[model samples]
Target: MLGGLHFWFEIRIFMHFIKKRRNKPLYKKFLPLRKNVQNRNKLLWFRKKKWQKFQRAFSRLKKKKLHDPKSYFLSTFKNFFSRKFKYNLQNKQRLSLFYGGFRKKYLKRVVKSTLKEFKSLNKHVTVLFIEKLETRLDTALYRTHFSYSFKNARQLISHKKVYVNNKVVQHNSYLLKKGDVITLDKDVFNFVILNILDSEMWPIPPKHFYVNYKTLQILVIEDIHYTNCLMYYPFWIDFNSFLKFYER
Candidate 1:
């Protein structure tokens, strides 16, 4: 009788599961589920790519600050708190408070004082401070096609495929002035500039700039030492040494 009762309970549970599964459509129960998994995996990949991009951009900003400590720190703090206060409030009332027409008046006073100090430094200091940063790696990544990650930009440069103004530059720290030109290796040629030109779902390109498909050229930097070395020893050296070694 005990064994019979157990068998009946098992049958009941199996029926319940069948009922539950039956409520879902056949397509969802089978094929759609696989497609859902595939979509999820694709999303995960894009998220990872975005995260790596953010990390690289942040690191590049940090390096710029280190290069010019006083200006960088002052600008950073000013931007940080200023943006924080701006976002902290809302609408016209928020704007009034930020601009000193509101009760606190403290925010307006701070802003004015900061501006005054900034102006006292130089007549064009404010303009310079607000100007967009033009880091070498950023220029390369923006102009020529290179690595997807900022950290990867430095690595790509080390590979000796990145050129700035007709010179093969391998330093991410190299700051760029206006009118700089960047080129990529033939291997990464398509990677640097391939854009989606379709009406399909995945329409967004990996980066901000548009790719000129017709003008795109595949030209690898041939007879390169680092490329050969890396091909042979993928995991043999540290990143810094590897950069220096290939720099030769």
Candidate 2:
């Protein structure tokens, strides 16, 4: 009787596990279609978790001191594994299609247009790549420890908490240009410098405007972001020309 009761109890626990998992719609419905959608979902989830852990590890390292080589080595290994994991997870074609259709729509459009324009103007323009502009905004807010995550930055801006050149800017992803003074809600100004030291984290904004602080010059005041700004650069008049013009 005890053996029979034990078997019954095991069966009941198994059923409870099934019931709990069935509450999640994806797992419930995705049992049979193991070919395309299920695999794609798995890849997406793996990439997301990997990226989150990578970000957390990087954040912790940035805050702590690295005196010993052993701790540094482990942290470096974690970073490498995180990047490799992301690369593996990102290699799926179906997942790419899903992301391209919805979440990465704007990014794809921007890249396609930029590449097309580059090819048209200079047929020699071989290397074309797309990077998220939001990454810069995120660095300004989080990695630099200026504020926090992108979500917090957006919240701060929408509440009229950020300013540019003495005017309130509610837009979070405001593409910064040279000579554009970025202030904080009319309170204090943080000098936005170009050619920043940390090139990996804070990439220099796509060069449209040129600034020479010594000469006190500003060139190509194109307030617009992300279009043909970086594509067309006339060889005759270099970035120095802008400085000379401003100097006079």
Candidate 3:
């Protein structure tokens, strides 16, 4: 009877777990994330639960350090299975995608063209690649603080809410050029301005662009190289690994 009761209780707990996770956003569903808050700019903190998720994970880690036999064994098991030791290539690919929503093929093209462009200039490959990546319209929007996250900027562009040079352009991968102008619908643009006006975020307005807060306009004054793309690029990314990924 005790064994049957224990099995019944376990089934009830499993059902509760399923119900609890039903409404969680897609982001919180990812597990075992050890990234710092600053490194996860793509996370939109729409709810307090987003922050609490990290807190809970950290609390779990703290419990593992208490030296209990079961805790030590569990921690050892996790460390044995965790792939952080082999994540160098994964980190490089993530860096390329984190700032912008471009895919592997697009990233390959960016790397290829950036290498060709560097033939005439004396610059590091990764730095030049970062400069080129920043030329994306969505990256500029996120850097300018017009959007909350890189994913948010891509959503706005894909929804046809962003305008380039007074024309509606839905492609998030559209590479920006010098003399190009960016605008958005008046209501949404004003709302964003108000949201960001009093905020102080990292990697302040890039030096390569001009933003007219009053007129809701963005002008690209300079091209790659002159831009401060490194400010937002994650420092942990292995540029050498990224180069190898693209070279292949």
Candidate 4:
């Protein structure tokens, strides 16, 4: 009788284990629901945090003289327009000066037309323009120290010593794209290796261009970062002014 009872207990335990295993699929179905609820809660938490930050900023603004809603709104509007106008004037002057002599009447029209075209082509005109300027074959060669100066870079290109994507390109103004490979002619490559490599006058390549000193090759990795580009040519253009001008 004891053996039979033992056998019956074993059967009961086996059945319990089977039932628990059967319930696992049902439990797994609810697991996704739990995870989704958790994700929603996290999103709500982030939104709440952002709203609180905005409220704090608004309160700080209120602590300033902008206590009344009408006054606050008016002051904000005035500040915005003032900043915008300043930016527009700066870019108009800079670009006008760059293209040619700065004539207020002529430059105004040029700025207006350029802004329209930029708006159609890209959302960030300043970035696009800087990218165009920095990625030219001559500019890249100069930055890579393959040429002593931008003028030298242009000369090298004009001599048919620069190859882009394995095709000889004599144009110094050829724009480079990401992953475009630039190779120098054998004579130029040898000259750079002997005369320019490790020389005191060798320039450090900008962050956007990758140089292979061993192979005398340059790869355009990406467009230069706006901040870094500014550091390199601060006087060339003012980005804030450009934005303001373009928006207007």
Q: Which candidate should be chosen as best, given lDDT against the real structure?
A: 3
Over the full model, what C-alpha lDDT does candidate 3 score relative to the true structure? Answer: 0.66
Give me the runs in candidate 4 sitting further than 4 Å from their true place.
1-117, 120-123, 198-203, 234-248
Q: Which tens-of-lDDT digit does each residue in 1-248 have in candidate 2?
A: 99999999999999999998764433323222122221122322434553554333333332122211122121122577685443333322222322222244554454455456665654322222222242233224433323423454566567785655667776655655545654454231232222123223322333444444343222334433435423321111122222222222
lDDT by residue for model 4 (1-248), tens: 99999999999999999998773422123121111110111222334553554333333332223212122111122577786654455445444433222356644454465476785774466666666656778777766767655656777889889899999998765779889999989977776775465444322468877788888888888766756655443133455555454444
Q: Supply the global lDDT for candidate 1.
A: 0.37
**Off by more than 4 A, model 3:** 1-33, 37-53, 56-85, 120-123, 226-229
Clashing pairs in 4: none
- After superposing candidate 1, which stretches have Cα over 4 Å from the reference? 1-132, 142-146, 193-248
Better of 2 and 4 by lDDT: 4
TM-score of each: 0.31, 0.34, 0.65, 0.49
Total clashes, candidate 2? 0
Q: RMSD for each model, in Å, please?
A: 21.9, 16.3, 9.5, 25.5
**RMSD from true fold, candidate 1:** 21.9
Clashing pairs in 3: none
Worst 10 residues of 2 by lDDT: 233-242
Better of 2 and 3 by TM-score: 3
